[model samples]
Target: MLAKGKDATAKVLIVDDEPAFRLLAERFLQQQGYQVVSTASVEEAQQQLGQFDADLILLDLALPPHFDPQHTLNLVPQLASRPVIILTGHAERDLALKAISQGAWDFIAKPIDPDLLAVVVKRAVTKHQLEKELLQLRQATPVSSPLPSLAGHSAHMESIHTLVQRIAPTEVRVLVTGPSGTGKEVISKALHQLSNRADKAFVSVHCGAIPAELLESELFGYVKGAFTGADKDRQGLLKLADGGTLFLDEIGEMPLPMQVKLLRVLQEGSYYPVGGREMQHIDIRLVSATNANLPDLVRQGKFREDLYYRIKGVTMETVALDQRREDIPLLIRFFLEQLKEQQGQAFALETGAMQWFLQKQWPGNVRELKNTLESVAAIAQQGVIRLSDIQLLHLDSQGGGADTEVVDSALLGGLDEQVKALEIRLIQQALQQHGGNKSQAARTLGISRQGLLKKLERYGLSHSSADD
Candidate 1:
């Protein structure tokens, strides 16, 4: 029998002429927690399937007057996406091979071993679920509202991804440069993930968001009474990130005095905390990012040229969404899947709406694209999504928010299945949102780090394949 925790809702269809055999198979599958349906022949099976959803089919070849596997093979095309496992006592080995060539998922020789049947059924059900996920990703959503994507077939993006794979293993300072929302932070997390230090801390600090007066203390800790507010000792980001990675975002905006201190840490592998007498030493990988042009900053005397060179051991750039237009549809699908968790249904863009999305300049880049998807999913119809649902020309007039109705809530799946699907998708999106930073993803999901790890395993979602 399949392991426990498998979806009890998985439906299996058993087609065999003998009533006793059919009864035995039905009882066996039910014991394994599958919803079972039985039919006596191909004709009855087809009729039953028209009103039932079956994840797997167990079809016996010698049914009724027909005793050929070819008859069952003929129904493969009409069965479409479902998996059909052939049950046969036929003597010809070549016939089994032919059955597989004709699209049978697998062949089980009769008198069927119940354990073997359970194993095949488990795998077939998993395959079907994965297929639905892939299919859901391809469908388009409403005008003005849309969808997720690490999706780009463009050579430029492909080259960037390739570079990430190659550069991730080396110990070097990496500078991620790109426009805001172009995924600079995403690449930073990828670098940390791909590197040998993947299991260690990936501490990130936003340089531009912090006040220069406090930025120094933020990076290099201060001892007790180091400052007016320093009632006790506090470790800086650098100390916290020992033996791991320190990500400095908006590096261009780092204060000159603080830049000198950072450069000292890079050169000496040690640092003096603010007003601290002790020089702490540690091993670390430094990754910095910026949307501003460092060369321009250096030329304008706002940034140190020496520090810029030290930080950019290697440079990578994430292009704007419009720069990789081929990825739009894929991103749309990804976003729709993410939206499904909260909205109870995923929406697709109509032809006119999708064309509009494909043509947009996307100044805000991937972030903007995702926000637009959320906006649209809020107002989309439950049935086939169309242009009018989002009120494309007048988006502001439309209530594209959580107030949106769930038109086809029941169409998605059973409540337990839906919850599991949502949990899986939410995990994926959260991982993407944090660039595979599990700690950050856990924080975003309001769960403990270990709890998130268990869930990731349960869903077969891996940190290594987060980008994929």
Candidate 2:
């Protein structure tokens, strides 16, 4: 009467010397609806792995003929690119921790509790399946010719490229949504490059970065003597973008009054300059991008619904980097190649360094990963990058960003407890800084809005709300 695993095809390889332990583990995993492959030795496990793409491995610390825990743990990665859970006795807990440091996903102590084993194994297997799916999706692509700036081979990236290829030829308004570092602007540029107006001027305006009072004049321009500072005739983004594409970045931050004006432009395609008697008309395509949740903003009455609908002719969303981890290695290689071209020297990552990079959460997305690599490469000697080089930079020491608060020694409790405390504090700070706007806070924290909501619920801050 056991329930099947979510991923029924998930395979687990057990490498243990004890026959009884192996049998028990195999039966338990099989009952959990996983394909079990058992091996009496590491050699047999290696042979089986060559034939079976195991999603996870149950490795014993005391595998003969190399009974040395460290040596056996070192061989885990060589076995396969999968999660390895060390099987250890209560007395061997220290060795199990060492196994983790040596790259094992987790460990289960002897006299294993079936419930605990099920939980740990299920978690690891689920993660493995997700990673596998991403890999398969990437490999299934027969051809990959991403835009110059949009260098990704994952299925998500492929879909984005396909959408752009289909929609780029048309003059539709596109609303790009996602986290800040996810390259919304790059997609916007691609739209312009593929459009019929490729040669025309492509003007960009950041609605959030510009002040409310100045944003109006910045977009619509002012005539000579319109104001004290208006010395002569000046062109605005709308005028400059005539016969081309006008990209509005962070359009959700446009003031309500400015939103009304933008609506008029989008509706009538005509606007008079500041203090101008004559109206100017422009034929242009509109492409807007924002990290904020426009629908939520519309509901809050901060964003005009009519404007949102007008600007949202087509919608595209960029996913967070962690969600598409299969692209990490490709991105690493791409960045390394760029570095070589720029610095006139070849750079390479050690196996351990590559594994370390793959294991990171990369909250800041592609931008953070690129920055970390640049920092490490700058100090790496002889163009060889290793885990030590990364550790020396302490790039991940303060959560994931350079601006995060540093951990203080005065904080009491274990590492996990202190880290949890820091997370809570950071979430509180983010919420306060953005006035409880969850979407904005999530962007600032380099996480998806759903991720932030989950954290808020977990930390019992679900009631926190303001302009959201």
Candidate 3:
């Protein structure tokens, strides 16, 4: 039997045709604290599913008008997200095995014992709830891949692998610095896998993604009645990471106030819940990653220097993909192998496509390259990926400019004409304001110096500005 008051919200659907069994099951489940819904036929089960979100279903193998097993088994796909336990007789063991193949959770022989029914329903509901929670957790902290691996042979990667091997077993905090989408999280997962605490939970929190006002409660959790919707006690990521590793991605984006609280927790190894009077103690290995410059943020007083030093016991820097161009082919091959393993179909790149991939400057680094290949693989004809397949997915035009409008009453023309006039006026003003220095003018106009020069040449104003 399940612990009392734990499954008060879990619902179960009964699809048995027999009225006696349905009532017995429903009453037993309701007494067990689960919301129960009953249906007399597969047809009715489908209708009930539309209105009721069940965590588990008690599915009967045969129905009236058509005592066929396949007829009832057809409902399995409709309840794909829920667990369906098969109801069968002692003589129908073979049919129950068939039901298992049709995706039934397990079989309970009829006439059903109340004790057995209670046990099976409770177990299925508990398992389903746990699975749902894990799914929600994964959605909350979206990772690059379900199974993160550092797959590359670049010199930078080699150094990273060596350093990870040396420090992963220790309790020292690690700070991974790199541009966005360079697989910093993968390195963090690798560290956890290599550590002595590998068997424990590996929790990750994206500091930049969460709102500043809510970050404290999110990390520290809260007790029941702590806030508007705090219905029950919840474990925060720090509490969940006890005896394991906690990865904080985009740590530089964390607010100063949250940083102070986090620093205190690190120093004292204990923290209070958002509304609780008592402090909770925890033990965890910390790993932080960010693309932002911590030193610069500290200099500007945006980040706390003490917190920065506390987090960065050792630093590992990942270079941009362009700096390690040789790893492009290796990464491509690794990604292709993963696709083949996952889809059970081989995918090959055409020579021209391979050459095209090798030549492009991937500003988004490994992530962009992997995504491009995945997209190409999806559209490739006959499992052969071509250059055109990839090219068709990307826009040909590379327009650079913000949607922000310049609020100047002096500019007057059609939309395009007005935009062009505004651009010219802004360029001229910026140039004049900066003493005709093109670089300084470009900075003022929020365009790259090269982009500014291209615009000047296109507008026939190349000679209007003097060089720095």
- Tell me the spans in candidate 2 whose CA falls farther than 4 Å from its real position: 1-143, 396-468
Residues 1-468, candidate 3, lDDT per residue (tens digit)? 122223569988888788887877777787888888888888887787788878888888888659887777765534534667878776766666555433456676677767656766676788678767754553354223223367666778778878888998999999999999898998999999999999999999999999998899889999999999999998888999999999999999999999999999999999999999989999999999999999999999999999999999999999899898877766777788789999988887644455456656678899988987898899887687754465466521112122111111111001245667888999999999988898678667644354466467657885655788
**TM-score-best of 1 and 2:** 2
Instruction: Please give, for residues 412-453, the per-residue lDDT of candidate 2 as tens digits.
Output: 111345567898899889989999988678667654344465
Model 2: lowest-lDDT 10 consecutive positions: 405-414
Over 4 Å off, model 3: 1-148, 395-468
Best-matching candidate per lDDT: 2
lDDT at position 315, candidate 2: 100
Cand. 1 Cα-lDDT: 0.70
Q: Which of candidates 1 and 3 is the stronger one according to TM-score? A: 3
Query: What C-alpha lDDT, on a 0 to 100 scale, does residue 439 get in candidate 2?
Result: 64
lDDT of 1 by residue, 146-255 (tens): 10134555776677777877888899889998889887777778778889998999999999999999999888889999879899999988988998889999999999
- Sort by lDDT, best first: 2, 3, 1
On TM-score, the candidate that comes out on top is 2
